[model samples]
Target: DVKVTQSSRYLVKRTGEKVFLECVQDMDHENMFWYRQDPGLGLRLIYFSYDVKMKEKGDIPEGYSVSREKKERFSLILESASTNQTSMYLCASTSGTATANTGELFFGEGSRLTVL
Candidate 1:
């Protein structure tokens, strides 16, 4: 079965601290994405990658960065965390296969980060 695992289900950090959120997929999907879910904003994309070593900024890329060094793993980096950055972060992936017309995404449980 395909699975996406997030490194943490809950996290807490203080202001000006660095945070790392990791996600891994066993399905070997070609596309991976990072999103933050807030009460009003819904799911907002923070970053995404189509292949290993390649990344693109999403809707809200400020205060965030990404790394895709391997095919199965992706990491989101917060250089200096702040209260504004606290939220539920999600990691997802897609097969990107030609035969699969559905742009379905497999998602991890999610990691909630709290900044004080």
Candidate 2:
């Protein structure tokens, strides 16, 4: 089974602090994604990397960034944590477009961030 492991299940940060959320997948998937899920907005993509050292911005990439130096690992960085960025963050990965790019996304349990 493809498993995505997120570093934290919950976190608390102050405004302007830099935050890092790590994700690791054992499946060696080519595509990995970072997303933030909110109450009514559903899941909004923050960033995604299709290959090592390659990155792409998603719909809402304002306060977020990603790094994928290795096939099995990816990290999301918050340049400056803020109250508005508080939300449930999810990390996911797929075997790339061939498997099912638009299929159900395999998500981590999610990391809840609270900024004050």
Candidate 3:
């Protein structure tokens, strides 16, 4: 089974602080993604890494960045946390194989961040 683990379930920080959200996957999937969920914005992709050391900026990457140092690990970095950035962050992984190519994503519970 593919399992995605997040470092924190909830976080509270002040404005302008640097924040790091870590994600690890048990499966050696070739694709990993980071998304932020807002009340009405739905799930907006922040970043994604298809291979180690290779990353692509998603739709909303202005305040976010990503790192894929290993095949099973992907990290999201908030350079300067802000109140507007408060949202539920999700981590997902896909095998990109034929059998598992149902266009489904195995996601982590989520990391909710609150900036005050």
Candidate 4:
């Protein structure tokens, strides 16, 4: 069984503060992704890393960045937090490239961020 664990399930930060969201995958998945979930917008990809020490900007990468130092861990960094950035962040991982890199994604519970 595969499991994705988020370091923090909930977080509250003030504007202009630096926020770090960490994720870990038990399975040796080659790919990891960070996504932000909002009411109407659905899941918007923030960033993704296909390999360690490599990252690719996703749909919404304006106020976000990612780091993949090791194969099992990926971290999302918010350089300057803002109210507009408050949302539920999800971390997902896939074992391998199953049909165009769209394998069965195992997701974490989610980290709900509220920027005040």
Candidate 5:
């Protein structure tokens, strides 16, 4: 089974401090993504890496960045945590298949962040 594990399930940060959230997938998926979930706003993509050492900016890349040094691991970095940045962070991964039925990605439990 495809499994995605997040480094933290909860986080609390002071405003302006940088934060790192890690994610690892057991499957050798080619696509890894970082996103933040907010009430009524749904999920917004932060960043995505298609392969090792390759990355792309998603819809909302401001105040955030990502790293993919290895095939199995992806990390999300918050440049400066703020009250507005406090939300549920999610990590997901998808296989390298080009089939249209690749379906949705597998998600982590989520990292809930609260900024003070």
Candidate 6:
């Protein structure tokens, strides 16, 4: 079974503070992603890493960055947290191999961040 674990289930930060959200997957999947869910904007991808040390910026990467130092772990960083950035962040992983890929994403419970 694929299990994605998030370090924090909720976070509260002030504006201009740097925040870090950590995620770890136990399935050894090659692809991991970060997304933010908002009321009107829906779920927007923030960043993704397909392999160790290789990352790709998603649609909304302006204020986010990611690090994939290991195959099972992916980290998302908020350079300067802001009130507008407050949202529910999700972490997901999937197999990268075409033959094993089912286009299904196994997701974590999510981390809700509040920036005040």
Model 3 residue 51 lDDT score? 89
Clashing residue pair totals per candidate (backbone < 3 A) = 0, 0, 0, 0, 0, 0
List clashing residue pairs in candidate 1.
none
Question: What are the TM-scores, per candidate, against the unseen true structure?
Answer: 0.94, 0.93, 0.93, 0.95, 0.93, 0.93
Worst 10 residues of 4 by lDDT: 95-104
TM-score result, candidate 3: 0.93
Candidate 1 achieves a global lDDT of 0.95
Q: 1-116 in candidate 2: lDDT tens per residue?
A: 76889999999999999999999988878889999999999999999988999999999999888889999899999999999999999999877665534755677889999999
Residue 4 alpha-carbon offset, candidate 4, angstroms: 0.2
lDDT digits (tens) for residues 6-115 of candidate 4? 99999999999999999999999999999999999999999999899999999999999899999999999999999999999999998765356567888999999999
Q: What is the C-alpha lDDT of each candidate?
A: 0.95, 0.90, 0.92, 0.94, 0.92, 0.94
Query: Root-mean-square deviation of each candidate, in angstroms?
Result: 1.7, 1.6, 2.1, 1.3, 1.4, 1.7
Among all windows of ten consecutive residues in candidate 1, which has the lowest summed lDDT?
Answer: 95-104
Ten residues in a row with the worst lDDT in model 5? 95-104
Question: Counting only residues 3 or more apart in sequence or on different chains, how many pairs clash (N, Cα, C under 3 Å) in candidate 6?
Answer: 0
- Tens-place lDDT per residue, model 6, 6-77, is 999999999999999999999989999999999998889999988999999999999889999999999999
Local accuracy of candidate 5 as per-residue lDDT tens digits, 34-100: 9999999999998998899999999999999889999999999988888999899999999874566
By TM-score, who's the top model here? Answer: 4
* Model 4 quality (TM-score): 0.95
lDDT of 2 at 2: 66
Which model scores highest in lDDT? 1
Better of 3 and 4 by lDDT: 4
lDDT of 1 by residue, 30-105 (tens): 9999999999889999999989999999999999999999999999999999999999999999988455475888
The runs of at least 3 residues in candidate 5 whose Cα sits more than 4 Å from the true structure, single-residue gaps closed, are 97-102
